[model samples]
Target: MKRLTITTLLAVAILSGCSSTEEVVPDVPPAELYVTAQQALQSGSWTTAIERLETLDSRYPFGAYSEQVQLDLIYAYYKNDDLALGEATIARFNRLNPAHEKSDWVLYMRGLTQMAQDRSFMHDIFSIDRHDRDPEPARKAFRDFKRLLDRYPNSQYAADAKARMIFIKNRLADYDLATVDFYIRREAWIAAINRSQQIQKLYPDTQAARKSLPLMLTAYEKLGLQEPIENTKKLIALNPVN
Candidate 1:
C-alpha cells in the first residue's frame, strides 16, 4: 500500500512537472523576434533574417514593433538582393505610413534599389563586355532618381539622387544623340531631325541637344524640308547661344 501511494505521488509529480514545463515555454514577443532578426541581419544571414522579420510582421501586425518591422523588412529584402520585393515593400510602407518618421529613408531606399538594379547598363558602351544594346534599364534608373528628387526635394537622399539624375540624363541624351547620328549616317534625315527635336524638347538643358541642333539644321537643309528648316531656325532663335 505504501508503494502504491508512492507511485501515485510520483505520477502526480510527473504530471505537475509536465504542466509546469508547458507553462514555462514562454511566448516569444514580437520585439524579441525583431531583435533576433536584427542579430541575424548583422551576422549576414540575410535570408534567415528576412524569414524572422516577415514572421514578426505577419504575426504581430498590431504589435508595437509592427511598423518598424515593416521598414526593416524592406532592408532585409534589399540585403537579400530581392529588389522587386524591396520595391513592393516600400510602396506598401509608403501607402500605409506616408508620414512615418522614416518615410524619407523608404523613398531613398526605393531609388537606391532602382539604381542598383540598373548599374550594369549605366556603364559606357566601351566599358561593356557584351554587345547587347539594351538601354532600357539605364532609362529606368534615371526615372527612379528623378522621382525621388521630385517627390522629396529636402530628403537626406536628395543630393545624391540629384547627382545620379544628372548622370543618367546625360547618358540618356548621349544615347538619343547616338541614335540620331546613326540615322544621319543612313541618310534618314526625317528620323534624325525628329530625334534632335525630341532631345531639344525633352532635355533642353542637356549638352547633347545644344550640340546636335547645328547638325540637325544641316540635315534639314540636305533634306530640302522647308518646315524643318524654319523649325530649326526657330529652335536656334529660342536657344540662341547653343
Candidate 2:
C-alpha cells in the first residue's frame, strides 16, 4: 500500500508538470484575430491592437492576411507610442516589400513616425525650445520625407510631407543658432561667427539666416574683425528682417 501511494504521487506530479508546459490559450483564427485588432485600432485601444496584431503576425506568417497585418502592426506600434518598435516594424516592411505598390505611403508613414517621435511634451506643451533637445529624430524625418518626395513626387502625401520637411528644416536651423548663441556666450568669437555663417549658407531664406547675420556681426565686433563686420552689415542690409 505504501509503494502504491508513492507511485500515485509521482504520477500526479508528472501530469502537473506536463499541464504547465501546455499552452493556456488556444490559437485564435487568423481572420478573427485581424478583425479584433482592427476593431481595437478603430476604438483607439492601441495596446490591445498591438497584442492582437502581433499574435496574428506570428501565427500567420504566411497566411492570406500577412501583408496587411505587417502594415497594421506598424500603425499600431506608432499609435501606441512605441517609437522604437514602430521604427523597427517600418524597417522590416521596407526590407520585405521594397517594391510594394503602396511603397510611397509606407515611406510617408515612416517619416511621420519619426516626426512624432521627435515631439516632446516639454517642447510642445511647456513651450521649451526644441533646440535644447536632440535633433536626430527631426533630421531623420527630414531625410525620410525627402526620399519619399524624390521617389514619388506625385504621391498623395507629397504636399503634406513637403510642409513637414520645411518645419523640420526651420527647427534644425534654430538648433544651429542655439549652438552659435552658446559659443557667443562663452566668448568664443571665432566659433560663434563660423557657426552663424554656416547657418546662413546652409539654410538660406530661413529666419535663422536672417537672425544669424546679426549674431555674426556681434561676434566680429567682439573680435574687432573689421572686414567680417562690414560684410555682415552688408548682408543684413540685403536681407529683410522678418
Predicted structure with the largest TM-score when compared to the true one? 2
Tens digit per residue, CA lDDT, model 2, 1-242 = 98798678768867975774322324777878788889999999887788888888788788898889889888888877787898898899889888999899889889989998787643554466567577899999999999999999999999999999999999889988889888989999889988988888889979988988888899999989899789889999999677
Q: What is the C-alpha local distance difference test score of each model?
A: 0.77, 0.85
The estimated TM-scores of all candidates read: 0.65, 0.85
* Each model's backbone clash number: 0, 0
Candidate 2 local distance difference test against the native: 0.85
Identify the runs in model 1 with alpha carbons over 4 angstroms from their true place. Answer: 1-28, 119-144, 204-207, 210-218, 221-242
Encode model 1's per-residue lDDT on 169-189: one tens digit a residue.
Answer: 777777788888888889888
Off by over 4 Å in 2: 1-26, 121-125
